[model samples]
Target chain A: MKNLFLIGLCIATASASSMLAQDFSAGSTAKSWNLYPEKKAFFKAKVVDPLCTLTGSCPDNCSSGKRQLALLRLSDNVMVLPLKNSQAAFTGAANELQPFCGKDVEVDGLLIEDPELFARNLYQLQKIRIIGDTKWTKANRWTKDWRAANPDAKGKGAWFRRDPRVKAAIAKDGYTGLGLETDEAFIKEWFE
Target chain B: MFKTSILSCATAALAAFAGPLFASENGERITITGEAIDTWCYYSGVMGGPDAVVGAAHHTCALWCSAGGIPVGLLADDGTVYMVLKIEDDDHSNGGDTQMTIASHVITADGMLYKRDGINYLVVSKIIADLGITNLNHEDYGPVPSFAIPAPKP
Candidate 1:
């Protein structure tokens, strides 16, 4: 019975540690832009709507994900703006941090700072987990959210090409998007 | 005279490109004239080529993209792009009222420029002059993506 109790305690402790630990899968951008060796920051912060924090333009539930979100570091009360995520290309970290609005989370990311130039630093969030939660979540939700929002934009060579909005816009605005007159002139000069 | 202007522009471009090599720990203070652009579409090319994604043509789309949290970049006249960290008193890079108001407008900005990972990041302390949609590329490209301006409801 004593042996069984010890085994249970060990299992529980391991499970608890696993829950608290961070699992980070670095995105392509993070791997490329790790310029400052000493800038990687891990800390607890509350996810906030930067507009509200800076402008006092508080909205309900961070404007229901309409506005960009940020982290107000609990330790220093400084606002850290996570411009990019761990993703490839030029994706932003809005959707990834949106879910945790107003809640405290453990952020594992790079803090890009230039004290002489920028008074506020920028964050590239690689991974995050709720302060008391078990599993860490990678900051790569932009593409996933884009796909979910655009269901019929399928069979993509490039996502923009297959997008219905792009097709409609091109059809209405024409290739140059200048106006029908310019489009006609362009077509006449180039294609015809 | 034209040759001298071309040579001067080339020299400026070279200097901007080589900025990071000589950057101090305090960063370099410079004044740059550029269009405030939506960085995502400019780099992603989802809308169109770099040329097609600026000025009056891409103005509407730039506003939409900025509102959606894409960081705004200042595409300088010398063809250098600076990812704006903050502009004036606005804290957020994108989606700030200041950024939204200047979307696609060419303005002379005085700021401190920071270079990292071959990217130019600017924190604009003041905007000297707002040149209001000077590119006029829409006369050539329409709205690079066209869909930026929604069709009027039937």
Candidate 2:
């Protein structure tokens, strides 16, 4: 009987650990943001494309990497727009939540609210976990995906400075993006 | 450059003062006129200086960034950048029809303003006016990033 009790205790412990396990670590911004303390919330939600939900402009897949995605909270049936991620700087959480489109996931984040007139609530997704799964995914995929896509653009002070697209555009349109004549005039007036 | 420096200093001061005032339980209501800008390129300065990245010159790029899930910001006439949380009934800040429609257009927005971490967040309840691509900088800066307009297929 003692052995049976020990076995049950072991199962309970394992289950609790599994239930609490989070796969991803939160970034500094997750805790440092002003709203983190008062607005943070963890709940179950389904990832969905906002365009399709708002208007019937449904696409084949949410993983298209272009459209914005939102979370439909299971508890209140309210759709939350995740404008930012856990990463520093201004980045969105679309790519982070894209893979889980249409699937229910556990989201750990903040629902920023302004209680005055005409104020709308916005979300900052810090961590996400697929429903029924033990691991949580951090909402920090923008930089990683950007780095992977621009493998050749290395040694960047800022990703923009080294980006091939930006370079090519500048080359084609001059530094000011104006025609050559305007650029020459501006340079002569400012520098010369 | 001198103007930009002064604006930057002024913006910093305003933000420092405004942050606490707006952070109250109830957000402050205000009406502001500004251009709907692409927050990514505007903040990153990837394409060009602040002056070059607005109006018709940067309209195409603004659309691209907004479509790619970068939240749209309203660059007020006073040089303040208000990160738009939501516009009217549209829930998402980026890639929404409303955002796409107003990309680079100068609009008078009536909304509730919330400031957090020195960043201003505006929830636009109504667009008082859309002054349609008023900044005509394209004449001086052609497409800010020429690549924003796709090259025609051969």
Q: Which parts of model 1 are misplaced by more than 4 Å?
A: A1-38, A114-120, A164-192, B1-34, B39-68, B73-103, B107-154
Q: What are the per-residue Cα lDDT tens digits for candidate 2 across B89-134?
A: 6655545557766778789999887654334667788999987667
Candidate 2, chain A: TM-score against the reference: 0.67
Lowest lDDT block of 10, candidate 2 chain B: B16-25
| Per-candidate TM-score against the hidden true structure | 0.50, 0.49
lDDT of 1 by residue, B1-154 (tens): 5565455545544454343333343558899999988765565444656788887677656755664467788888767778776677665653556786677778899987765433566768899999766787866876557554444454
Residue B38 accuracy (lDDT) in model 1: 74
- What lDDT score is found at residue B106 in candidate 2? 86
**lDDT at A91 for candidate 1?**
58
- Residue B139 of model 2 has an lDDT of 64
- How many clashes in candidate 2? 1
Listed for each candidate, the true contacts retained, as a fraction, are 0.08, 0.06
C-alpha RMSD for every candidate: 17.8, 17.3
Of the candidates shown, which would achieve the greatest DockQ relative to the real structure? 1
